[model samples]
Target: MLGAALVAKKASELGLQVKPWVKTSLAPGSGVVTKYLLKSGLQKYFDQQGDLDETVASAIAENDIVAAAVLSGNRNFEGRVHPLTRANYLASPPLVVAYALAGTVDIDFDKEPIGTGKDGKSVVQSSVLPDMFKSTYESITKGNPTWNELSVPDSKLYSWDPNSTYIHDPPYFKGMTMDPPGAKRVKDAYCLLNFGDSITTDHISPAGSIHKDSPAANTFLSVGWIRKDFNSYGSRRGNDEVMARGTFANIRIVNKLLNGEVGPKTVHIPTGEKLYVFDAATRYKADGHDTIVLAGAEYGSGSSRDWAAKGPMLLGVKAVIAKSFERIHRSNLVGMGIVPLCFKAGEDADTLGLTGHERYTIDLPSSISEIKPGQDVTVTTDNGKSFTCTVRFDTEVELEYFNHGGILHYVIRNLSKQ
Candidate 1:
C-alpha cells in the first residue's frame, strides 16, 4: 500500500504516465489489505492502472521474445511466477511499481527516467497504512454466506467427500500396521524418468496452471469439471488422486527417454510404448514392478516442496539416483520413504553409458537396520553395468524414518503405542 501510494504520488509530481503496453495487476494477500488500501485513498491509483481484484494475467511474449515478472514477493525462482516468465526479479514494492512504469527490466534506475513528463521533461525516479486489525479479525471464524451454506460433518474423523475433487482421504495410511515395515530392497526397478541437471520441484510437481490436455486436467474433466473450473495444481493439492496424476506433469520437462523432445512423457520398457509419466508409472505399478528415477546434478533444486517427494512416492518410485540432491528435498524424500542415492564423484548416467531403458537393481549390503548412514551401496543394470552410490541417509533419525516406511508412518505407529 505504501509503495503504491509513493508511485502514485511520484508519477503525478513528475507528470508521467504508465506505459500503454504494460499489463499491471495488484493482488493484495488478504481482504483486510484491500480495506486498508481503500481507507488510505491509494486503492484508486492501483485500480486505475491495474485490476484491483483479479487474477494476475502474466504477459505472454510473442516471436520468442523473453518475458519477465518483477514482483514484491520473496521468491522469484524458476517456474514460480509463470512458466512463460523465464526472467524473474524480486524487488521492493516501490521498485516493482518503478519497473512496471519503465515497462522493461533492462534499465539502470540510477540513470534512466521511469517515464517522460507531460511537457516532455525527463525525470529520475525515486505513507501510514490503516490498521483495522481488531475489527477485521473479529469475524474471522464467521465465514461468508457461501461457506455458511455448506454442511460440515460433526465427527472426530473427517468425513471425506468421495464425489468432491478438491479433497480426498489420502491412501498413505490405509491398511497400515502398528509395526514398521523395515526397509525393503528395490529389486528389478525400471527407470521411470531420466532427467538432466537442475531438475526443480516445479518440474517434479508443478504448481502452475494445468494444461488442458494434462492428466490432472483430464481427471477433473472426467468428473464433470469444466475447463474454466479446473483450478491450478496448487489449489487441488489436497487430493492425492490429482497430485499423483500431476507428478512430473510440467509441460517443459525434458525427459531423456523422449529423444530430445521436451514433455512429460516416458517409455514403457516391455511394450516400448510412449505414455505420460503418470500413465507409465500406473502401468508399472499394475505389473508389480518397482520404479526409480535417474537424474543429473542438483536434482530437486528449487523450492523445497513436500509434494516434490510425496508425488514420486505416490507414483511408486522406490528410489532416485541423482548426481546430487538438494538439501531439503533429500530429507523430504527420506520422509516420504523414497531412497536418495548419489553417484560417485565425476560419474553420471551419460558417463557410465547407461541408457534409461535398462532394468536396475539396487543392492543394499545388509538389511536396512544394519545399514549405516551415508554408507556406500552398489547399483547394477541389466546391461552389464555396475556402480556404487552413497546412500543419502545423513542421520540416524533419517534412517529410522526410512525404516518405518515414512515419517508419517513412524509418527502414526508411535502414537498408536501411546
Candidate 2:
C-alpha cells in the first residue's frame, strides 16, 4: 500500500494518472499488514490509484488443519512446501485470489458461475467475510500496528513423519550435552582426502546420480539393488550411513592422494593399499584409527552443505586443515565436533611439503571451552616435525560444541537443563 500510495500521490500531485501498462500487488509477510493499511485509511489511497485489495478470500469451518499450503513467494518445487502432503501447487498472487474466490476445486472456474449477487447475482456473506475479517483489522488503530492482533497459524509445530527418508529427525538431537566434553586432540590421524582449491560441499557429499562403480553403488549392490534401482545419494541423505559412504564420492572430485585420479580414490598409508575413500576410512576405523582431511585454498567454498562436514565426521575424520574455508562449512566442521585448522601465513600444503603420507597430531589447549577463534595450534608430523597453525574456531561456544561431540549434543544438554 505504501508503494502504490507513493506512486499515486506523485501522479495526483502532478495532475497525471498511472499508466495501465504497470501492474502491482500487495503480498506482505503477514495478513495484519492489511489491517494497518485499512485502519490508517491507506486502503482508500490504494483504491484511488485503482489498486484493489485483490486479497485471496476463502471460508473455513471450525477446526481446520492445513494439510498443505502453497505460497506465492519464491521456492516452489516438488516436495518443497511439505513432505507429507505428497502434492504442492504454486500460483501467483492474482491466481491465489481467484482460487480463494472460487473456493471449490470441484467446480471449474471457467464454466461455473462463482455465485449470484444478493440481487440475484450474489449472496456473498460466505464469500465477502461477514464480520471477523473486517473488524479484526479495523480493531487496530490507524498507522499503529500491534502484534497482539496479528493473525498467526493456530498450530504450534510443524508435523513431521518419523519414517520419512528425505527428512527425518537429525541425530544431533539424540544425545545432547549442555556441558560439553573437555579438550581433546587429533591423534594419529591420517589424511582422508587431499584435494586442490575450490572443493565445494557438493564435491564432498553429492546428491546426484550415484556412479556405477562408486562405493555408494557397491553398498547398494551389496544390499541386493539392481543397476536400475540405484537412485541418487541426495534422496537418501536422511540415513547417515548411505550419505557417509557417498561423501567425497563425487565423480568430478580429483583426490591428490591418487596422483591426479579424478574420483574418490585414496591411499591407505598404513596398509600400503589403494582403495575407495569410504573403504579406506572403514578399514582405518576397524584398525582403531582416526582421520583428517587436507585441502588447498578456499576449501568447501560452495553451497553451505551440512553434509560436507557431517559426512566426514561420520567417516571418522577428526580434523581438517585447509589454507582457507568458506564461512558456513567451517562452522559446520566445528559443529560436528571436528577440528578446523588453517595454515600459518605464507604456508600451505605444498610449502609445508605435505606428501599425504605423514601422521598428524593436532595439539590442543588444556581447556577446550577457552579455545577462541584464531588461537594457535601445533600440528606435529610422525617424523618429529611440528608447525604452528591457527585453529579456525570462531568462538568458545563453537569449541564447546566440538567438545560436546557436535552441536546436537550441546542442544540436547541445554534442553535437558530446562
Candidate 3:
C-alpha cells in the first residue's frame, strides 16, 4: 500500500494519472492494524494528489490480471508478501499505482534509455536509483525526513520496527550491548566477496518456515518463547538474539556435490566439525569467530525481509560477497553495516571455491580503497589457498554507506549533527 501510495504521489508530481489497485482481506470495513505508521499529516499528502477514479476502481474489481500486474510489480509489495499471502493478490488503489510505476522506483542517473519523452522530443532517461537516493539523502540531511518516512502504515502485518531496529540494524552496530574488543579491526579489514548464480537470500540467511522441532526452535523454546510465538522465521527479526541463533536454517539447503541426506552445513564447536548451516553459525559465534557470507547471481532473491541480512550479521557475519544483488536486500545489508561486494564478470563464488567453511581473511582498507569497477581482490582461504576474485561495490555512494556503517547510521549521524 505504501509503495502504491508513494508511486501515486511521485506520478502525480510528474503530472501522471494513477489508479492503484490493492488486494486485501479487510472485508470492506475491518480495522486492521499495520506495522506501517504513516504520519497523519501524510494523509493530506495523498488527498492533495487525487483519489482513485471510478472507472479504474470498476476495472480493478472486474479484472484480476490488471490488478496483479500493477500491485505486485513494484519491489515494495514483494517485501509484504509472506506476511499477507492470502490478502496480497486482491486489488486496491494504492497497490495498483505502485506496480504501474515499478520501473521508476530507482532511477539510474548514469544510463540512457530506449524511448522518447511524452512531448515527442528526444528524452534522455536519467537513472532513478541515484536520483531518488540522492533526494532521500538530501531530505534526511536537511532534517525533512526520518527512517519513519520510508516505513508503511501497517503494524500487525509483520515483525520488527523498520523505523527503529529492523534486521539491518545489527551490522550497523546497533543493539549490541557490548562491542567486541577487536571489532574496530574487523570493521577495517573487511573482505569483498563475489558470488555466482541462483543465490537467494535464503542461502545467505534463510527466512521462511522453520521446523519447530529444530535446534533454532529449541533455542527459542529454551528461552521461553512458545510454539505459537515461534511463528515464521521472518517474524523474529527484531530480536538479534533469536536471529543470530537461526542463520541458514533452510530445511532444504544443499551445500555440496553430495546428493542424499544433505542438511545445510553447520559448525559444531564441541567437535569442531561443520554440521548444519545454522549450527555452524551458532557454534562459530559461541567460539568468537567472525564469519561472513558470499554468493553469486540473484543474491537475496526471495523476500525483501531485512532479517535475511540481519540474521547473518548478528551471527558475526561481517560481510557478504556476491556477483550481483537484488535491489532492496543490497541496501538492507548496507543498512546493517554488512559489506556487500559484487564480483566482476566471470570471477564468481564457484570459481573462488567458497565452501562457507573456508576461513577467509580480508585486507579491507587497502583493497577496498583501491577497488574499481570490474576489479578483483585476492583472497586467502583457511587452507592457505590464495586466489583473486572480483570486488562487488561499484559506486562511491555505496562505499560511503559502508564507511558510515550502513544507511540508517549515516542518516542518523548526519541528521543529528545537522
Which numbered prediction scores highest in lDDT against the true structure?
A: 1
For candidate 3, lDDT tens digit of each residue in 1-418?
Answer: 3433444445666765432432222111211111121321123224433223447545543552223322333332311332112123434655444434442323332463212223311111221234444555566545545655765657664455554323433444445222121112232221222234665665556454445556667776776877666665566665565566556555434444222333455444236464655565556667676666666677788666666777766666777767778888877786676766665677675676655446676545443355454456666665676665554555676666666655665676667666
Runs in model 1 deviating more than 4 A are 5-25, 30-32, 47-65, 109-112, 116-131, 137-152
In model 2, the clashing pairs are 116-121, 116-122, 117-121, 117-122, 118-122, 176-409, 177-409, 178-413, 207-234
Candidates in order: C-alpha RMSD to true structure: 4.8, 15.8, 14.5
For the record, the alpha-carbon RMSD of candidate 2 to the native fold, in angstroms, is 15.8
Model 1, position 99: C-alpha lDDT score: 83
For all predicted structures, in order, the TM-scores are 0.85, 0.60, 0.51
In terms of lDDT, model 1 sits at 0.82
Model 3 clashes, total count: 45
User: Which candidate do you rate higher for lDDT, 1 or 2?
Assistant: 1
Better of 2 and 3 by TM-score: 2
Error of 2 at 204 (Å): 0.6
Best TM-score among the predictions, by candidate number: 1
Error at 124, model 3, angstroms: 47
Compare candidates 1 and 3 on lDDT and give the better one.
Answer: 1
